[model samples]
Target: MIEVSDPNEIAALARDPNLDRRFETPTCPVNWLLLKRSLKVLSFRGHRFPTMMPRDDAQRTSNQQDLWNLLGEKVASIKTGSDELEPLADWVRGIGPDVQLGILVQQLLGQLFSSKFMATEASWDAAKVLVAAPRLNNLPLMMWWFVSGKVRRAKRLLAGMVNEDLSAVNAIGIAVHNVVKSLRQMRVLYANVQTRSGLSAEAAAEQCLFAPASVYRQATAAGQLGDCPYSRHSLFVLSIGEAARHAEGRSLVFMEDSWSRCPANLWIPAMLQGVWNRASVFSQFHDEKLSG
Candidate 1:
């Protein structure tokens, strides 16, 4: 396994056709077995999660592009003052001062799906399980996680909740969870800086938007990324958030200009800006009331 933290190398590696999403080969046989077992948790029935699909998969690519186009429409409407933004902003403002992560996740899920999106405590637990399953290093626990039907039960609970395509359900749940967690981090940062007078909502959102920690890819052929030489089956762990610390690396946060760039790059910041706009107004009103 190779860990890549440099921004340029990470971007170049991501664009390499030979480096795809398949996790078929691991540096060691033990990991190979573990990865295979863990992948079961990310699947619904026999369908792999959309994010786990190989780039060359025609159907997955088409479906992802369709989702991107749909999100683009939403972003466009938002630019023209869609009514949806205020309600979402209000919902975000309503998050408590010290809400638990699970509750925050549940609320965010509702915002992403329908307000009537049925999610239980177990549903959130199951999503957490799926996210962590890929990193499990304990052989016995990994075996139990799959053998005990825990993975199947979790997938069953989430499958078809979003759409008939099980992959869509898994994809939405995982993406929402990840984005919300990053937003939460941004919220903390925003709180520290929001008191500065005349801070625009756009500036606040841009200052606070946190990047994802890392992403993974597997090599299908030998390649040299930067000065690093990697063989086929080499696993590359790209540290995205770390790379984003540098000015040149900011684009790594959303993978800007890359084929795998996040579709919601514009929408996410806009949502954050809306929330900050509402929250700032509320804060000012409260301050005036106190002063009076």
Candidate 2:
């Protein structure tokens, strides 16, 4: 396995035709088995999570492009200053000063998935298990979790909450969790900023837009990406979140220019900005009421 964190190298490697999302049979038998298990945990009812599907998957490509176009329409509408997100902003504003940050963010993002979506305390508990299952590096423990039905239960709860929409599952299950983490970070930064009024909502949102921690690719054949050399079936771990920390690495947040770029690139930042804007307004009003 090769781990890459440099922005330029990641960009070059991500665009390389030889490297793709499909996990080919690795040279190591143990690794190959582990990859198969990973795919199992990441899939539901025979459908691989959209993000986990191979690049060459025609159905995935077509469906994802449709989602992208839909998100683009949402972005355009949002840009017109609609009040569609005021409810979410109000939820953020109403958060108790000492509320559990993780749970609060998860609940807030859950609303974005669907108005019918509701996260109970038990759901949050299950989510912890579900989100961590894919990241477990131990084969034995992973197998034990699966066999013991722990993983299956968590997945069932998640699927039920999202009405079995795989895209919603992927978004809430794998993607927006990082966005939640970053929003928490942004909240801390907003609180500590000496000149909060000077920070635009858009700027504040951009300050916390985080990329996924990493994405994997497999080489179909021996090839060189920048200075890195890889053999067939070698796995490449692109450290997207790390690269996004660099000055010019912001684009990596959404992989904005890449073939695999996130569909919600514009919509996410806009939604975040709207939340921060409403929250700031509420804060100012509360401060004035207290002072008066």
Candidate 3:
């Protein structure tokens, strides 16, 4: 493990955030290898695009081509899975966007053990590399096979270094997954009292007026009935009751967390209810009485 000898060094790097861009001048081991990997992943499943995956491209610029060749050589030389990551991660952090590199490193480390979702046979070497992977996404991927019986895909905007509490990362992953899944449906979007500082459950209730009655009902029923602080700029979705009553294709509203001042956790259940409501409506429309 490369011990960061000085917090000041990282702090200094943060202070001049533009320092990463200096790599544009180009050099050997050109950071483009990490860049290409990051771009590949981002283009594939990132919010920005849907079609993306690994492939060979002869059209890549000379610098990018050189990096690709270097990566192939390094990957070929790497025996232990553990040996493939640290240097790659370090190189990633040194050049290219940190967020992008973090995602790629996490994906690479996860892929090393299993193609994507399956867990590799237990290997001490793979476990060690996963333990030291740079992102929380990697942690959850590692835990899925090793810890939990659930083989769910990891879905959190963790975007940075691995947090100290691995459980917290898991919780956040579950939370974000629930939230995004809810958004895809016409479920209720919840709000909270989060800030750059922190949040309180009490704050969640006090500002609950902005939420729909159904959302409040779900929140109250779940015993999640309080205002909790959320990210400064969070968006939520709520189904339109009138739209559902009319049997419309879909109905939802996007609102800001700050404006609603409600608990964000309530969003998931609200979504469940909306989906249930839509299903009920659909069944009624079909009028297919059961013979039972």
lDDT of every predicted structure (CA atoms) = 0.66, 0.74, 0.27
Give the count of colliding residue pairs in each prediction.
0, 0, 11
- Backbone clashes in model 2, listed as residue pairs: none
lDDT of 2 by residue, 2-24 (tens): 88999988888878998887876
Question: Model 3, range 60-147, lDDT digits (tens) per residue?
Answer: 2332334335434443234222333443323322333323333333343334223433222222223323322222345456454434
Q: Write the per-residue lDDT of candidate 1 for residues 21-105, one digit (tens) a residue.
A: 8878546775476456646666676777776678788887777677667666666445443454444444345555433455454
Question: Distance from true position, residue 61, model 1, in Å?
Answer: 1.9
Error of 1 at 165 (Å): 3.5
Off by over 4 Å in 3: 1-5, 21-26, 44-292
What local lDDT does model 1 show for residue 169? 62
Model 2, residue 179: distance off in Å is 2.0
Name the lDDT of candidate 2.
Answer: 0.74
